[model samples]
Target: EEDKIIEAEAQKLKEKFKEKSLTDKMKDLLIRSIYVEMLGHDGGFAHIHAINMTQKKNILSKRIGYLASTLFLDKDNELLILLVATLQRDLESESYLEVLSSLQAISRLANSQIMTATYDQVHKLLSHSSDFVRKKAVTVIHRFWQINPNGVVDIDRIMKTALCDKVPSVMAASLNYFIEVCRQKPETYKDLTSSFVVILKQIIEHKLPREYDYHRMPAPWIQMKLMEILALLGEEDEETSNQIYEVIQMTLKRAEDLAINIGHALVYQCIKTILAIYPNEALLENISKSIKAFFSSESNNLKYIGVTALNAMLKIDLKYAEDHQENVVECLECSDDTLKLKTLDLLY
Candidate 1:
């Protein structure tokens, strides 16, 4: 009912924008109203409003540009070409802010044509002298690769250079990109095994600066990505398996002092890596103990992770399902829907 009312008002405001007598203040307010209620809105008036708002020389106008482009524009929209043109013009500017904003807007609203047209500029920004520009550039590349992997030219070279970057933010962004690419083409990164494992070990062992911390803890996202990549690379090779096993053991040991949610994610990914690569009785027992410890944690997140890990373990060996039956059954009484669902899965 409220959305319908907002839509009605938005329609009225659209008609008001057509009036030549409308003041700039009234126009701004109308844009804000439409911006707030952009959801479920499919009117063409927003395209003109966003374009007008974007042309104004102010921060508010720039923000409106971002919001409007993200909310109102899609690949098939006729207005996308205008948005792309504006972004390209901004990118060509010498101002860092302009380039950054353009980079951000493109990341959010880029279509195949936008990606293809702006590819070289973003690629050059990876090596930009400013860390801020480089970081944003790496992120844009990552987003672009995700949407169209083949759209990114020289990705192997890009990944290799990004991973070797001195900045933590740059490295993290590159790792994220690498994780995605490796998911689709795991064998393409086999050559980086030794270097990748070394970096993962350093990160897991807390050897990096605080910049790497996700939430005041070691970077769990990077750690989990590395574990996944390791699982792929080490699956059938005894030497690689040993290397990953040691890293997993260290990660589990470090989980004791970490934040509950972070610890749970780490343990969950660690268990998955172990199961994927080398699931010996000893490794399984180690994961079993980790999950049991998570169950004992006061944090529900940990408990959910525990249940999830146990559910996965049960698939590998039904004996685990039997061993942890009592504990798993207790989870059914929890109020958390996800935990309840996983517990029910375990029970059945």
Candidate 2:
């Protein structure tokens, strides 16, 4: 049956083209490989590219894309492919995107499966021109960091390179992705928060207002990402919460990090993030009296943030329940569902 099929294809090719140049031969090879891939033999794609009939048509890496995506569905296969792809120093930019996409798919694979990340390749792709391509690299790298729960991306090196990104989209993508992975594995990223720290520190040194020019905002993808990681970090660590508090303090006092409108919105969002992830006792014990110390003296923004965080504190065990009753009453009066349920249960 195989012999008959080959014969049939030979007959079709011969009759389809009696005269062909080198260019035609190359096109034929590409078309045949595409056909072969469609028939399920993806492993042969590289060799297929190597045998191109045209001298001018460089199809080697481009043809291999079809093969790499299949590796995305399986971890063992992915790691083997990653090793091979990473070893090839001349890989075109397209191959990097293929690799990044494959790794992105890995997040859906079995959680217990362990695989190696091509941190070198990921670092390279972060500099590419395409936003989508660069963004995929960010997601894959950040996810890997989450799995390792350690700062393997070389925080210092990343900080040095991050500011070099020609495009804010790329810079934001890299920083925000790092933050997300840290959020996922907070216990591992304490020192790795340098990017955010650096940005905040810069804001303080220049005495810049939180209000920056609205014309130069982080890309939408980056903004959402920072928000996500912020919420996650707040949910995971006391130190992170405190650090955010410090950044907030810096933002309030320095007022140099943002412009008036953007600063107002971002400050609210930042403190909200801090409250959401602050955990129940993360603040009340050491900072409890200190928290109440300035409760009534600040901006309405401060009051809102304090009350929200205060309500989170109100959910303690029965022994500590009575201490935050007024804050709980304040929380219950608001019309948010989650806030209402949390405070009403205590009141009843």
Candidate 3:
């Protein structure tokens, strides 16, 4: 009877240990593993996972999940590598879904620590039968661009392969990454970006566009950058890019009413670059006339920009606006646009 009681007590203790929640397990793991490897105190998260498994519970489903969950979230670099290892080798789709609460935990982690292993894992995720994994993998890869400095990233290769991904999300993300890089300062990655755009223009075989692609493929970055790059280039380069940019801008500008929810700043950048490049006489003969018409019909923000660009032009070559003052006055009188326009009129 004494032996029987002792065995029962041991069994009860085992069960109790198994039932401890994920947080308690994290305390054990961090204290043991991560602390030693990273923090120098201890070094083994196996126990945390051990406890978590014994409990048959989802770490993400519990409150302390945030602590464990963020290990794979955006900022935690080391944890991201660990999570991608699991994503590729440890967890299956159905099990991962039940075990993890937020998708961001896995996706953002991958976005933060992309490497050969992570890249392969992302390809696997894209190839997964699950649409969710494929979609998330695509978005995660695109988000990867935001964290990568140019020296570290193989952007050309990524842009190359991503343009042809079987999945829409992957393709879109890759294109967007390229586009975002276009907005960056030239001194940082000018040659690479310019070559990429120029290559895109010549190889009509892999043709991209200036206008927006509402379909699964949107290449606004490539589209605008291609035009802007060409505009900044010498005569031959400008000829190709300028033709595309001018037409696209004209169409897009017409479509965007004054009350848009976004995109004013990006378009403004395009306009600024063009005004800065055009010669005073050429600007007067070419841009000034249409610019006046555009401002006359535009909303407040457009008017403000028009005035600013005009002033800058006048500053650079007094003859630009001075030569076209009659057209400017006509647009000003008919401006009937906004208070900003009226203010611009008085100021000018």
Candidates' C-alpha lDDT: 0.75, 0.47, 0.45
Candidate 2 displacement at residue 159 in angstroms: 7.1
Which stretch of 10 consecutive residues in model 3 shows the poorest summed lDDT? 34-43
Q: Runs in model 3 with CA error above 4 Å?
A: 1-103, 106-117, 126-139, 142-155, 165-169, 180-273, 276-290, 293-299, 311-318, 323-348
Clashes of each: 0, 17, 8
Candidate 1 Cα deviation (angstroms), residue 316:
3.2
lDDT of 1 at 208: 86
lDDT by residue for model 1 (1-348), tens = 878877887777677767775545544654655554566555566566676566555756666666666666666777777776677777776777778878888878777888888988888888888777888898888888877888876777887888888876677777777667667777777778777788878887788888778766677787887888888877666766776677677877776557567776787888988877756678888988888887877767778878888878877887776666667766777788888887777677
Q: Name the candidate that leads on lDDT.
A: 1
Q: Which tens-of-lDDT digit does each residue in 1-348 have in candidate 2? A: 765565555455444444545343645544654554455544243332332221122444333333433332344443334333432332243545444444454433312233243456555766677766566656555565566645454643553365445545445656655564564677655654445555555544543333432444333234434545555655656666666655544444332244444544554454445446565454334334433432443344444544554555455334445555565565656656665664455456
- lDDT at position 286, candidate 1: 90
Which candidate, 1 or 2, would have the higher lDDT against the true structure?
1
User: Cα RMSD (Å) between model 1 and the true structure?
Assistant: 3.0
Error of 2 at 149 (Å): 7.2
TM-score of each: 0.86, 0.40, 0.47
Please give the TM-score that candidate 3 achieves against the real structure: 0.47
